[model samples]
Target: MTDLAGRTALVTGGGSGLGAAIATALHAAGADVVVVGRDEAKLDAVAARLGRRARALTCDVSDPASVEELRSRLADTAVSILVNNAGVPGPVAALTDISVEDWDAVFDVNVRGTFLLCRAFLPAMIERGAGDVINVASVSGKRPLAHRTPYCASKMAVIGLTSTLAFEVGPAGVSVNTLSPGPVEGPRMARNFRLEAERSGGSVAEAEAAFVSRAALGRMVTEEEVGRAVVAMLDMPGLCGADVDLSAGMIA
Candidate 1:
């Protein structure tokens, strides 16, 4: 197991789903964790479940004022690990049918939020000459998903940002990488399947089957699998500038 004892980790969107799983895993590895999200109840639930090693903070990542407020709140805390996991699925539609508002909303959370958090926390890591940064991207970022232009584009931006930041901070002994999971089995994936079904005039089951067919494993990845990947990333050394694929060969 990766020994993260005495370290403090920050995971955004840690209220539920993959975020909560990652936070729990980090806490299990002996790290004090801060779970940040916009939903107070969800965040509180996660924090409570994580016991004394975890705490919750509410922040709207897309808003500068809110991010600044979060930075102020963490002024005295040292964050050794940062996970930029907050994201939206965005509208499933043809490019021509997608609205500017929908596209911007996806980018605001997936891309801008990651950028803002990195901006807020990276300097401290650099100053300490040690840290890990994981940006939760998607296989859609590497490959393309039809009718998911906004989400795919935003995640692609995340991969690009992660790669660039890795190079920029590697000299300071901080590792930066992207974790790209494919069609994770969860409410988010179910919702995406539903949206695709509506867009294609197909049944939700067919949409889900189509997604599963894209994976060599013929199934969506589990949340615990993602949590294990996060822990592996934290454990590995000299793993900078890598886009770690937890996509069940979907990218291949």
Candidate 2:
């Protein structure tokens, strides 16, 4: 891993789960980290664990004004790393059964939020001629995941956004990439498994097995592994315009 001794990182959705894990990894790599999320208590909890090198900031990534406020708050800080991990899992139902509002909400957070953050932060990096951005998408975007059309579509937009933005910004020295993980065993997946079981009339274990069986590894990746992969991606200077899959051979 690269020794990010002088870098500063800002992570969205860095309160719990994968976001928290990524922030922890970046902190361990010697980067001063700012954990951003809607929950002050949760963000504070994460920052507290990282000691003086970390701080919490509150923001709604989907709201433009919220992002602007966050940018103003961080005017004095130089964030060299931006992790756009804030997302929402949309409704688990057939396309015809899904409501328009439900579909819009998913795109608002997953796609719009990523776009807003990048729009807010990328300029400073461009001016400085150095930065890294990892938009946390999912393998579902690249492949197929039944009953999650909104999520898959939104993530696919993020991937496309990253790829195009990378080419536009690489000449200016900033690197933009997407990190797509497969099934990471966590509260999120647990909830998803329960939902799948209810929909399929199967046990939760069976639902989980059905999903894991698709992966060549026959297992799920951990949040910690995803975090480590983020660090590894940062270490590679030439990795611009790429969507790196840490999917346990699920997409391989």
Candidate 3:
């Protein structure tokens, strides 16, 4: 079991979905968690549910100024665990149909945002000689997803970043790894499926079914499953510079 008592963990995009679940799991493991996201109310709601062990902080991860503000606010706080979960799905369209603005938006949140948070918090972890950084990527990064060009590209960048950071920081006793989830069952997944259905001239149910068919389990992965995987990653001391696939056989 991972004993995180007396540790402070910061989870970006912790307002809902996988981020919220991760924050809850980390708190349950005895870590003081700070949930950061753009939706203040959502963050507050999650924090309230987690009791005093959790607190909410509003932040737009894609914006440098906003990330800097977060850095300034937590200047005195030592974050022993950092989870970069904030990300955008990007526009579901072919590469030819995707505009530069849309592609950049996805990269800003999924790549630049993770980079900024690591830049802000990693030095302290290195100085302390102990810390964990988990970057939430997706199976889409490993395999091509037909219409999600920007999101796929951004996640690939995340995986690359995770590997590079792990090598650079491992000597300081800081472990950096990427957790790539498969087709998760959630509102976000539903939304993406709907968009795919429309683009393919099919029904949402059909699209969802097709997605499940690709998975060996013939079903979507749960948010709680993803949460448990995060906890497991934190508990494993030997894992570093690795791409942990929580994709239910989808990526394999």
TM-score of each: 0.98, 0.99, 0.98
* Model 1, C-alpha of 62: deviation from truth (Å): 0.6
lDDT of 3 by residue, 135-226 (tens): 99999998968989899989999999999999999999999999999989999999998999999999999999988888888888999989
Each prediction's RMSD over C-alphas, in Å, is 0.8, 0.6, 0.8
Tens digit of lDDT per residue, candidate 1, span 99-150? 9999999999999999999999999999999999999999998786888888
Best by lDDT: 2
Model 2: per-residue lDDT, tens digit, 56-142?
999999999999999999998999999999999989898999999999999999999999999999999999999999999999998
Off by over 4 Å in 2: none
Kindly report which residue pairs in candidate 2 clash with one another.
none
- Clashing residue pair totals per candidate (backbone < 3 A): 0, 0, 0
What is candidate 1's CA lDDT for residue 62? 98
Task: Give the candidate order by descending lDDT.
Answer: 2, 3, 1
Better of 2 and 3 by TM-score: 2
lDDT of 2: 0.95
Q: Is candidate 1 or candidate 2 better by TM-score?
A: 2
- Taken over the whole model, the C-alpha lDDT of each candidate is 0.93, 0.95, 0.93
Residue 241 shift from truth in candidate 3, angstroms = 0.2
Tell me the lDDT of model 3 at 170: 100
